[model samples]
Target: MSLSGTRTHLVQTARLNTFVREAGDPSAPVLVLVHGNVSSSVFFDALIEELSDTYRMIAPDYRGYGGSERKTIDATRGMADFSDDVVALLDALEITEPVDLLGWSAGGNIVLQVAIDHPGRVRKLILEAGGSPYGFGGTHGQDGTPTAADFAGTGGGTANPDFCARLAAGDRGEEATSPLTTLRAVYVKQGFTFDPEVEQRYLDGMLATSVGDDIYPGDSVPSDNWPGSGPGTTGTNNGLSPKYLNQRAFADLDPAPPVLWIRGEDDVIVSDTSLFDLAQLGKLGAIPDYPGEDVAPTQPMVSQLRAVLEAAGEVTEIVYADCGHSPHLEHPERFVADVRAFVQ
Candidate 1:
């Protein structure tokens, strides 16, 4: 599963031992790539290769995912724990100059946190199928108002137990809840396929996810609201909960960096009608006791993102037709070209 021209290694940042995948010249302007949930930096291999000639690419595994040190994510800090780890990695590498950042899915939220907290450290920002500034699920409207006081339909409890079980067991079979099936059905658009070897590599990354109450999906608490569960104060999923995570302050930054927002037109994971959103599922009758739209309306994820980024400053958006969550993999050439044109 080794990618040509890519170098993989571990860096002992102050926070943890971060496994990093690097490509291109070390002296070139750095372009840090952050991956989303259930996957690792390995997801960016193709894009790194395509843009290596002009950018020093550094993709690191988050603490509980891929080859990074396994550690408990303090959900109370939102994504600060993850963003601080990225900052520590840059410090360890002596990359004092601001670097370009590109985050995919959940990673997009982490990068936005970095830009919000450490604005001077980022030269530019790119979000690919990124999460909303208010975090994922349990919210509605462009302003991201909470559907329930407990933020019930979001976080660890929102994860499918069967999918987590299959992932923990490294089930490569194409069963409906298996990682492979999710890869094809959710990670990319329907009918899209990856090269067998590349697919295996990506699956390997997915399988590396550390499953536990203090890690993937984190922990949950019983809620009085619909779906009956709320985010617990630990784990990655809770960290992503609107209760713990919110990047709306990004708009308040004195000098926000320019942004390039890219996403697949067919992305479902972070869409307004995301299948994973409990409210959306309830509305569709997939989950019972939906509590109606007023009590628990579908989250306007894309609209929330657009509103925040627009308020922040400069933003350039690109939507690719016939694509899904992983635009870099589905349209590497265009993705790289779009990024190059922006970062340059």
Candidate 2:
């Protein structure tokens, strides 16, 4: 089943034409990798190379991101579309049995949705720096109480406009918010670096992201909340807002799968005081009108996930020291070893 070659193909699923990178023997156990926001399956290339021998590897670009078709993402579904798309991919591939699923960041949200909605299809779940069970923002406590009914402090408007513009323009410069700079600084541990050629490939996948109100950062709504912004009725990040997203139902799965929650100790993107979250920014005076913790405290993302998973049973937590948002990229060998052991 071991193989060194990588192959790319367009899987014609009922939902959208998915672009997949696969390797290893077809007869082997399946390992599907789902990537995060502003990123494609390209980030998993190194991990695939390291684990290809042990299991069949399949990494598919989600509909709006990479080589996949630029289909519209309906934010109201609360990641149901992404979850359904993955199941459709498995169906198209004729993968009847349960498969090991691994998701990173936003993809972590997708995998949890799949496990909750289609429990039979997932044998095990790996959440790497996944979004909070309460969703991305506008929450107060571990219970994920909305800071505002509109879920203000979250959604599409929060995305850095200059960054989105640069991505749309395919700017390769190293200035702040540039795709390359983000890939290095925010995505991984600050000093960790990827091979120059591979970095270029991943950057191409990142820039391939469809920039609009219906995708990537998504849309927004004005709110009475401190930040004065809230989740819109449409878009990806909005879909993830507490108003639309919550996977606490995962604890109710009849035959809950074993879960591996792996995260980087230094991951600023998904931390308790996430830089991307407006609530944290507001507390730090990064945003105007400093709100006290009672109004908008740092969303306890890890605590929320733990509370749900621990209730479900058989959850293992691993925090990688010195790692950032992407453990697979910042520490590939360790990530590969841990995942291989988990799946095996």
Residue-by-residue lDDT tens digits, candidate 1, 7-91: 9999998899999999999999999999999999988888888889999999999998999999999999999999999999999
Prediction 1 TM-score vs. true: 0.99
Alpha-carbon TM-score of each model against the true structure: 0.99, 0.97
Find the candidate with the highest lDDT and give its number.
1
Error of 1 at 197 (Å): 0.9
Model 2 ranges with Cα > 4 A deviation:
1-4
CA lDDT of each prediction against the hidden true structure: 0.93, 0.87
Q: What are the RMSDs of all candidates, in order?
A: 0.8, 1.9
Show the lowest summed lDDT stretch of 10 residues, model 2. Answer: 1-10
Error of 2 at 89 (Å): 0.5
